[model samples]
Target: MAEAAWGNGELARAVNRTGTETGQRLKYDASAVSHWLSGTSPAAKALPVVLETLARRLKRPITAFEAGFREMPTPVDKSTDTVSGLIDLGSLDMDPSRRGILTAGLYSVALTIPGWPDVVGRFERLRTDPHLRIGMAEVRAVAAMTERISTLVDQFGGRMARPMAASFLVNTIVPYLRANADEDARKAMLSAAADHCYLTGYMAADERHDSLAQRYYLKALELAGHAGDHLMYCTTLRGMSVQAVNLGHGSTALRFAEAASSASPQAGPRMRAFLTGQQAHALAQTGDKAGALLHLRTAEVAMDQAESKAKAGGRYDPSSLAYHVAQVNYELGDREGAIRAIQHSEKVRPMVYRGTRVRHRSMLAEWQIEAGRLEEAVQNWHLALDDYLAIQSGRADDRFRSMLSATRPHRRNPHVRELLERARPMAGGRGSARTAQGAMT
Candidate 1:
């Protein structure tokens, strides 16, 4: 694999580049590659870097299991491969012993594989089964269930909601997809199933299960194409971009974002605004400060147009727009701008979105820390913790860990020490500040 991806001394150089991107200073050479091929497993951190390098060169998703570093049973159905993949992912995700495999690092880069357009096109030609009957009511039920699940994810967190979503996909939605229905009903059902899969994928990502989340998102994108729902297709692509950016794949992130925008040229103002904001975030990540700022302005203008054209209801929420602005600002080193945008997000955030509220508060605290307002940062961290303790979200846990890591240097200060002591037990199984420091090394 190493020679196939890079000739001679290039593999070591590629690994070093990946390490630099990931903030590690690896010193692997051809000797390490020889050792790896001879059955010596790389270090845990190095394993991901290696797999990611191969996946990037191969232009597809790669897993530790596929590389022979671990054993896992592959699914059988070639026809419904993506669906089968989802089932396997959900099963693995729900298994306590196996869940750790999904959280492994550097998997996000694999998510930017350029084959999704082809996958979408191929799936669109698929014919539904002609046996078991399905109806509009079943389709509506899936849609309604998605709305309720979205609420649950917002209030409780994906850790509490993911199992329910996975079960629904496996038990309810998958069966409907396999059932017979009129052409129109089948299309509706496909759309509904796509929505459910997207939600499940989103929750999986929120739970820090990137591998599972990428599979679900791909499945969702395929189903959306099959249904000929351009909007849903664009949405799934945008979700992929979000995941890529979060994992620090800036160029790939920008590609996915631009692809989403291109896929939906005639989208409404609200949808356009959301897509543009995603582009802004990608630009910010790639150090295109001017491009990022330009897109941010475009997003704001698009949002205003969306609001003005709202006849009965608005498709895009202002809170999402504000959140994107904050993210772009943060990426571009505008801490004050980030905080102001976050405040706007908070103002419009619905009361039911407690999990989002917790995240916003955490970001605010992080910004406060960046601004050297230690006392204010501690206060905000305390407020964030109050809400964080109530949510069962891996994303929230990530924020909590980040808080601990950031405050570690100031632990000698009374307030920082007090927060650190309080957060120790709440760290769940991720360990305390000491372990976090150890991991950094």
Candidate 2:
């Protein structure tokens, strides 16, 4: 506070304002700051808000320990049993009353990622139900259920799908993990569970529950390694890169992307494209222009040669490639190219991906507005609203909020006025585009 030149009241006001922006109602003032300075701790729910306020003021990452709170969880603690951890996490996520605690977690950029070698085949023996046995049939069932949930999430958004995922994970997958099985079937079940865990983490990230998503991602990595499922392991790492990049953590995103690529020595063209596309985006954000373009071209070529599949990472198709292109162009300050690529993405994108449709359309409008094409931007925003109203998504809410703020200056335009009128009733929801913008620095 001294270094940032903030008085007690100023810091308290900033915390309260930030908490409100993020959907919390905080009432801190000079007295609260005075108490904190006298060794009183903030509530668990408010600690993140306070830390975020300080980090914003100081322009650096500040951890709980650095702010006089207890240290955050160590990255990839080896002693924790993955199955038990999944049960605890899923239980909390599934409960509406406890879910707010999970969502309050801030995304940490300072955490170290576990290496591939360190995770592979690392498993501690967990309790098993001797009478409850599972076979390949159960493994197949888990995989099938995960696929169905994934489809629902892509179409309708994670706001609805994630609760179902948590329920299934806690009620079904955890027992399967603890059930007895043959060696081969056991490994297959572990692999299947890892994929399901990865999907849940993806949903959490989609909902912008960053720290909870990280926990799920870490568990997925552990499960994948225990099963020796290299594909899921690499895929999970790449997914982490996506989460980090989306949150505007450039160097952290690049590091995860490179780690994912290095871990997958024998990846096929589709997987190659999947990993390289993210690498290109991260590189562009990190100002590695030569590396960004080089990897992007590699992704394009790999995507061309890629076989179409209904499996996990194999879903990175031409539409996904175009979205990556748009991101790269946007990061490199090519707004026109970014708009064009996003338009192309919308055209090629399959109808099942309604969630992406809302996101991409909203993003296209934002870019168009930035490029000073108000009419075109309004048209896209209207299209975005057509789907956005039906979905439950944090990302969509962020985009919706952005739409409101971005069009405030153009309220005199009849179309903008009407859009604002339509969106006025929904303005009080959470999720901020500023978090993404803040990460750019």
Candidate 3:
């Protein structure tokens, strides 16, 4: 309270506000704050609200231990059933009023990842809706909805699409999970749900909500295990690796990537490419230049084999492979090589991936500026802006902010000045891209 410079009443009101926004009917007041200050712990449910309130004021993540509450046994405590946990998480994510708190979660580098055996066949007893029944049709519906969400993320970014995904997860998918079904249908639904959760987690990471992404990713693992979907289990692990790598947690990312590869005994060519590409990126981030290059070559070979088979629909492709190459080059201090690889990524990237275009192109511009190619950088920035205008993504917003910061020193240049002037209104009118929210199975 003293660090945050908040009075007892103010702290209580802030906690109360966060609680209410997240669907809790909290009635904390100054008296309650006084009691807490006198060594009385808040209720279990209210602890998050209190911590989030303090984090907001302090402009950093506030862990339970730091806030004088007992820390969870693990970074992410898994005390509840997976299905129920998903429902709660989805409910909070869908509520517009709760976005800030969810987005503010700290990425847990020490996240305890469940191994294949740990999660396999370990389902909590779900409360089935005796009156409800689901079948393959409902399973297909869920898969289709997940695919649609993926497309939306590819095009417009995660911000606009994630709330809908969360609402669907809570209002539709959970009920289906609880609905009576044949074994085949039940397994199929579980796989579909796992895919949806993975995609939702990816979106959460895209928006920079690392902790929320890990939660969804972990649930995806649990669901995949229950479904006996080894492929999806591995895919979710790779997704977690992607989240960790993007957030600069190199060892954690490599752990997830390696775990994904090690668990998938039946992985095909495309799967190999997907897994290895991420491994290369993680290895690069961890400063394993030789190992990273070796993995990168292996990924390229696998991608070639997969494309020869005319496979489609998998997330990893030539464009994504090039991205890994770019990431590897950049990590190893090969800025020029990174620039070339990323440009290839942009060239071969499909038109439907408008959000990625914005991010990658903007990144390309940043590299160009660093290499003293201001003219080329300015042009790419303009192209990035062309796509940026249509998307609602936190990552894209990050790129926009980066552009402003990077170009400020060169503002005297006419091209840079013109770009800044063009971006002025966008910076002013942009949505709350302040943060963070994903499917594949």
Candidate 4:
């Protein structure tokens, strides 16, 4: 029989809670859970997520498709079902060039839908016709404008960033994609528009809305493939992989990184090395010290190769550079290295990245705790916690728990205790230190 929710909508409520908790949507049919319990597998693409979801609920490890699915032969109540319907496209592990793109896109769509018409109908008609030849300068100009808008987002805040980025995607880039008759130019413009999405997605990650961030990243990859921009495709995959690892989805991150690495040869020198660096990070997260070290060494070689050309072909940006180096070191238990990397990041990044600054500082505080700088760590954590709550980051909330566990040994220590207490709120949803940071708006 198919799975059915019990009385009072409790099951549905549980289903939604678990789905949001595990980053998956639950299936209503309970019988599919039986098919999964038998030798039959759920869909291959989302199999990993589903397996993890069940394992989490059952309090055990359940590897899907291992031993032909028949080993798990007993039917059981389907308390949770993670959605695994999302495609396992290879580019989920690209660079974070497109940070907060989707939130911006969604926000923009909501805003413009009520106000604006497709005012460019005449322009759109003229641009896409095959007879009309677009100048190379126009393409370059559009690309340049896109880059500037991304810059503005970083230098300013999201309020300014989202609209500017979305405008470029809708106006210059997509119009070209829609209007151009030439296959190559159409491809070029589509890729550019897709890049805007990717950049905004990266911004999402900075805001700590990881799941939403991920959706945007994937969309960018889909668009990039249509443009046949293999380098961009590889970059997008690397970004997603980085995000996976960042959010503690280590194995998923590794798989994405592996795909990016395999796809690297077709990518440029910078992106090729970047993918390897991502693998190094995944290994570190999995506690494969020797393997992690080896990959790190490999990454070093790749970084050197990528840097040798001296010409900028979409290499790691300033925040990414710090985030990458710090991630590997943080995973490998090298607190000092993480500290140095974060310090460097603080210097290089502009104030435009107000949100990014909060995260980089959080990482720095993490290094402080590891390095026995308890007071400093506490201060940083409080700051980060405040920033995190404002952004509504469940991922950050989970990370905060992990951080607390990591520092549990020092719980009785004065600095730790005091910091913890200072970090607490006056109950009834009032007077949180986070509130003192002022309204996030």
Q: Please give each candidate's TM-score.
A: 0.82, 0.85, 0.82, 0.60
lDDT of 2 by residue, 110-133 (tens): 556677788777765569798899
Candidate 3, 1-441: lDDT as tens digits: 899999999999888877754458889999999998788899976787788788767755677888876645337665678888888899999998986667655455656788889888776555988999999999999999999999999988887788999999999999999899998999899999999999999898787667788889989999999998999999999999988787677887998999999999779988999999999999999999999999999999989898888546566889999999999999999999999999999989889999999999999999999999999999999999998878987778888888887887888999998988887767755664322100000
For model 4, the stretches where C-alpha displacement exceeds 4 angstroms are 1-138, 156-160, 167-172, 266-269, 310-322, 344-354, 378-441
Model 2 lDDT, residue 375, Cα? 94
Clashing pairs in 3: 199-438, 199-439, 200-438, 203-437, 204-437
Q: How close is candidate 4 to the true structure, as a TM-score?
A: 0.60
Ranking by lDDT: 3, 2, 1, 4
Model 2 misplacement above 4 A: 1-79, 307-313, 424-441
Model 1 Cα lDDT, one tens digit per residue, 20-58: 644579998888877766778779878778778777777
Least well predicted 10-residue stretch by lDDT in candidate 2: 432-441
- Whole-model lDDT per candidate: 0.78, 0.85, 0.86, 0.56
RMSD over all Cα atoms, model 2: 5.2
Clashing pairs in 2: none
lDDT of 4 by residue, 160-205 (tens): 3544554455445544554545656656665675576788667556
Q: Name the weakest run of 10 consecutive residues (lDDT summed) in model 4.
A: 107-116
